[model samples]
Target: MKIVESHKTDVDNYIITHHYLRSAPAGARLRLWVKDNSDNVIGAMMWGRPTARTYDYNRILELTRLYLIDDTEHCAESKALGMARKYIRKHLPEIRGLISYSSTGEGHKGTVYLADGWFAVGVTRAAAWNKQGRKNIDKSQKIRWVRSV
Candidate 1:
């Protein structure tokens, strides 16, 4: 698995694949891609936004876009999340904590955020979206989680 601060171009394809890709709006994302021995991007994460237009900034590193394919790297999820936090604390110490949101409908979390010491801040009544034409996410009811870095 390789963790990288996205070079912009390297990530356009994957982000584009998500239907609501704009919600996580990629601006200045720190990314991690887990590649198989054949070097295919199986798991990925987009770590931050350049600006907080929708979600409020809380002096925390916004760890979003945690993605992993089935059994790609076994521990890719945990490793990717760790790299995300470590990278921020090491390189961007100005950020105070780590925060992220997940849908209850997202089924289950696989020890990535849990192992990193992230905890539930509160359950959001509705997940808000900043897009036009459409409202927020249908799975609007999500749980917010946070961890201090």
Candidate 2:
């Protein structure tokens, strides 16, 4: 599979339609598509500033979305991640690390991240937007994974 630049609209649509969350992130700094040898779009990814205030947004980015077609070849996610990392290292040199979370509530153990050389740092506490006017959000505890670029 080959990684290609993708438009936000196309990536968002693909994520919304195929991803389990069924929604796109609000601010994606980079979007990408994974195409098979035959040129069919088989996956999409989005990277953006980390949501947590502790992370240095100028140096660290979060993989906010990653969705692949169910029938793709084995290790496709790992390959896509490897390509994306190389792209970021070359094009966004200021970036020093990448992070992503796997939701325990969603039964995700972060196998793809592990396979791509990311390490689990810790688990985040379950919290939510408790403001009176805000809508309820999933406060699932997540495993934080990180990879140095």
Candidate 3:
């Protein structure tokens, strides 16, 4: 498989909204498609500015979404990641690093990130408070990973 720069419109309906957990792409700076030997799109990835502030906000980009077509052979995710890293290095020279998260709530341990040699930054517990006459806490956790571009 190979990675190619993609248009937001080309991937949103066919890939992200339909296949990804978030169902939308907001603040996306770059979109990518994973294609097979026959050139059929099998996966997609999206990179954008991090929603929360970080030390190197200007130089850091988050791999917000990565979805792959099930039933494919192994290493597809790894290949896409490697290619995406190269693409970023070649095309987006200003970026010095990349970040991505795998949610424990979603049963993900960031296998792809680990396979790509990303640094493990530990886990984060994210909580949301809702005040509707009473207090409610919505909580989830994600493991963070980073890699230099």
Candidate 4:
């Protein structure tokens, strides 16, 4: 698989259509597409500032969305993650690291992140976003994973 730069609209659409959440990220600083050898897009990724205030937004970017087609080749997610990390390190020199959350409510074990060498730092407490005018928020506890760019 090959990882290539992608437009936000395209990536958002793909994620909304294929991801279990059926939603797009609030903001994305970088977007990527994973294409097969035959040039078919099989996955999409969105990177943006972290929602939590504790993270240094200027230096850390969150993998807000990662969507892969059900029939993708084995380890495609890990390969795409590695490529994205390299791309960020080369193009976004100011970035120091990357972060992503695995939702326990979604039954995610973060296998892809673990395979890509990201380590779990801690678990976030379940919280409500009602003050932000978002209803039915996913208040599930999340495992925070981090890796240097």
Candidate 5:
């Protein structure tokens, strides 16, 4: 397995095909892929400008999407993520920090980030979403994480 920079369209297709969210990242500035021996993509990740106003957008990149095919060997996701971080540092030298959040609604606990040496900054308060009579509790409490480059 190896990590390589990926095009946006390819990344979008991979994510749509494999990710549980079935959504493509918007405003993506960088995309990476982990390919198996035959070059079939096993994982995909995307980085983009922070959506919220919490950080210096110019110097901070947000990990908008990270999806890996299930049943792979251990540490594959974390290794791909680490390689992507190194790629970002080498290619986008101006970015001095990285940020990402995993949602409780998705049953994520930021384990990958934690394993990769990211600092856990606590979970954000929960907020529900309402739209046109639909009332769903947005239990996606984000567990925010950061890593200095």
Candidate 6:
């Protein structure tokens, strides 16, 4: 397994194929991909500097770019998110609040998020990123469920 700073090499593919964490900027703190021995970009996670979103205020840091190939299994994503939260606390301790967004039908994933201790903050009526139509969360998508780190 390898963890490194995110590069553009296959970023487009990662973004095009994933959600929630995909829309993050090319560069951000902790943008990582967990690859197998073959280096098949399996999992990723990241955190953007605090920014204003549909739900939380800018004072809260945003969790971004978290994705994993479906076959990699949940343990890998958990490890990545756990490491990510740890890294966030280490580097941005002052900014203690962490927020992540997900769609509504994502019930099972939501359970995982909750088990990880993320609380349901609220729902966002607007797209988390409005300018990007693809990122737009229509009626089908729900707002972010936030957590304190």
At residue 32, what lDDT does model 6 achieve?
63
**How much is 12 displaced in model 4, in angstroms?**
0.9
| Per-candidate total of colliding backbone pairs | 1, 0, 0, 0, 0, 1
C-alpha local distance difference test of each model? 0.62, 0.90, 0.78, 0.89, 0.81, 0.61
Please, what is the TM-score per model? Answer: 0.73, 0.92, 0.86, 0.92, 0.87, 0.66
- Give the alpha carbon lDDT tens digit for every residue of 1-149 in model 1: 66666665455557546424334455544665655567676756676742335654545557666666676655667666776677778887777777777766655543566776778777766535544655534445556677766
Considering only N, C-alpha and C atoms within 3 Å, which residue pairs clash in candidate 3? Answer: none
- The worst-scoring run of ten residues by lDDT in candidate 5 lies at 130-139
Better of 2 and 5 by TM-score: 2
lDDT of 5 by residue, 52-118 (tens): 7968889999998888888676988778778877887899999999999888888888788888899
Q: Give the poorly placed runs of model 3, Cα more than 4 Å off.
A: 20-22, 129-139
Candidates' RMSD to native: 3.7, 2.0, 3.8, 1.6, 2.7, 4.2
Better of 1 and 2 by lDDT: 2
Clashing pairs in 2: none
Shift in Å, residue 62, candidate 4: 0.4
- Cα-lDDT of candidate 3: 0.78
Q: To one decimal, what is the Cα RMSD in angstroms of model 1 from the true structure?
A: 3.7
TM accuracy, model 2? 0.92
Query: Which numbered prediction scores highest in lDDT against the true structure?
Result: 2
lDDT of model number 4? 0.89
Model 2: residues >4 Å from true position, as ranges?
A: 128-137
| Residue-by-residue lDDT tens digits, candidate 6, 1-149 | 55555645465456546765345464455466667768777766666664454534444667655677778755666566666666666766776677776666554346556767788867757444545455433344566667777
Query: How far off is model 5, as Cα RMSD?
Result: 2.7
Lowest summed lDDT window (length 10), candidate 1: 19-28
Q: After superposition, how far is residue 67 of candidate 3 from its true place, in Å?
A: 0.3
Residues 25-102, model 3: lDDT tens digits: 467888888899889888888888975585466788898778888866697898799999999999989999999888
